[model samples]
Target: MTAAPDARSALRAATTPDHERVDAAFGAFDLTTREGYAAFLLGQAHAFLPIEAAIVAADPRDLLPDWPARRRGERLREDLSALGFPAPPTGDWAPFRHRADILGAIYVLEGSRLGGRMLARSVPADLPRSFIDTSDSVRWRYLIEVLDKLLVTDDQHTLAIDAARRAFALFEAGALRQKRTKAFG
Candidate 1:
């Protein structure tokens, strides 16, 4: 009999397309310039604030004890302020109804930190970078441990995958909205 896929692998496989879409959408921003960087942060704020708020409301502490330390919404806000841009209004996000759902969203948020490291190199050194500069491999490993431990059932795995996909979609929408406003141009 074939061994079952682990939670992380399953989620990655399921959401690869959505993840790619988000990467392409955000990749259009020219991060080397202040205008481009600020717009990119604004797009991130629009999606992250609402979703992170919802995750906090759900109280995932039982599943993720370090949830408080993992939040980056405030950091994103600080970057926006430093750029002289007002906080963009957050849009409505899908609710996190289950623990699996919360985990899925966390996956997207944490995974972004890996990508953020690469993007950070593009930003001018003088600019604020608290949000993207903070990438913790230990925290990521812990999250993977939790995901593998808790997402034991196929149903739970499915829920997590769906939630991750939705999170990616929210990010894509946020980037599109920012682009539409032409705030950076």
Candidate 2:
């Protein structure tokens, strides 16, 4: 018999489609240009601010002690302001009702940090990059460890996977909305 997948592996496998869609949507931006980069940040702020607020409302400190430091909304806002744009209006998100749900959302947010590092290289050096440039591999490792320990049941796994998919969908929708608006153009 095959050994069961770990929480991280399971979540990753279940959400790969959603992840790909979000990546494709956001990847359309030309980060090398200031307008493209600002639009990217605006879309990110639109989705992330509300999602982060919902996560905070769930009070996941017990699961993620360093949650405060992990937040990037303020950094995104700062970057937007530097580009002469105000913060985009936040949208509503369904509340995270369980620890597993919160874990799933955190998975998406932290996972994006990994991609952000790569995208950061594409961003012009003259632009503010506090949101994407911040690196914390150690925190990521800690989150993985937490997931392995806390997510031990089928129900827990399902909740996490569903939450993760929702998180990805939010980002995907946000990117499409910003792309259509051409708000920064």
Candidate 3:
């Protein structure tokens, strides 16, 4: 182990590869089409709300004091309705048992906002794609700065890394589930 280890660094290092993988996988999804965007939002709602509920329940005010403003479940819901899609019932997710797990999940969730502007650009001018239209980066920057200061031990770092991986897998599964639904209908 290197000297002066930190949960921030350890978590980033562990998640870098996974982050890259998620970016590529998400990039492969074509959001230019109405059906594509609908499917995207469907899966997004499925994964995001459950994880958001878990972390919000974990009480993140200590770390992310602005959690309320940062929350996006409402926006996702609005987008779904704008597209005339019904919000389907999502299955239960295992609640995060540790603060580190919450942080890891939030890392994935918040990190996603950094790429939202690009996704927003992909939408047709006439379409309502507010879900990915986060043009400002202030919130994203704040989350990073706050995360950088939250001291986590090696054990916590490991758990955070695992949680981040699970977050990605959960999101992908949600998207796949939507695809299957579309195919079957």
Candidate 4:
């Protein structure tokens, strides 16, 4: 049997390997506190769900009844519009449509589990990576990585979730230390 692709490999395959751009985008956020990290994930979810929703719409069976995928996509698009993301009039979701099943799975496993609409709406365009022109392909790629871990793992400890939470905490701690050092120096 073929082994599932690793997260980075999946991302590289689904979207351009733009680590520099991704990191630069990530760097734009504070990521130094629980709220900051939560905001970051929600920002991703806010952007992520629209594409995810479309995929779900492509096949509604992928998610729980109330969490239809298409609605998720529409919501994401609506949220983006509400947040003033200028319409990418000519943007093509063909790439997204082609992989609807995979993207739908990602939405069910990742985007749906996030905080809530309020948190999502609270994420503004000025936030980190918020205006980096992220494509549905890139978002799907990232979501696949995150969701694959969250959904596929059998361990109840939720290694991926726990790791992500801890990683954010560590990042926040480091940011705090850096700030202190900068101030004291």
lDDT of 3 by residue, 71-143 (tens): 8877888888988988766557688787777788888888777678778888777777777786457876676
lDDT of 3 at 104: 83
lDDT, ranked from best to worst: 2, 1, 3, 4
lDDT of 2 by residue, 87-183 (tens): 9776688988899999999999999888899999999899999999987899999999999999988899999999999999989988998889875
Single out the weakest 10-residue window by summed lDDT for candidate 2.
Answer: 176-185
Residue pair clashes in candidate 2: none
Backbone clash numbers for all candidates listed: 0, 0, 0, 7
Query: Which residue segments of model 4 deviate by more than 4 Å?
Result: 1-24, 29-50, 62-64, 93-185
Give the distance in Å from residue 69's predicted Cα in candidate 4 to where it truly belongs: 7.3
Error of 4 at 81 (Å): 3.9
Off by over 4 Å in 1: none
What lDDT, from 0 to 1, does candidate 2 have?
0.90
Give every collision pair in model 4. Answer: 32-172, 50-73, 53-69, 53-70, 53-73, 56-69, 57-70
The alpha-carbon deviation from the true structure for residue 37 of candidate 2, after best TM-score superposition, in angstroms, is 0.2
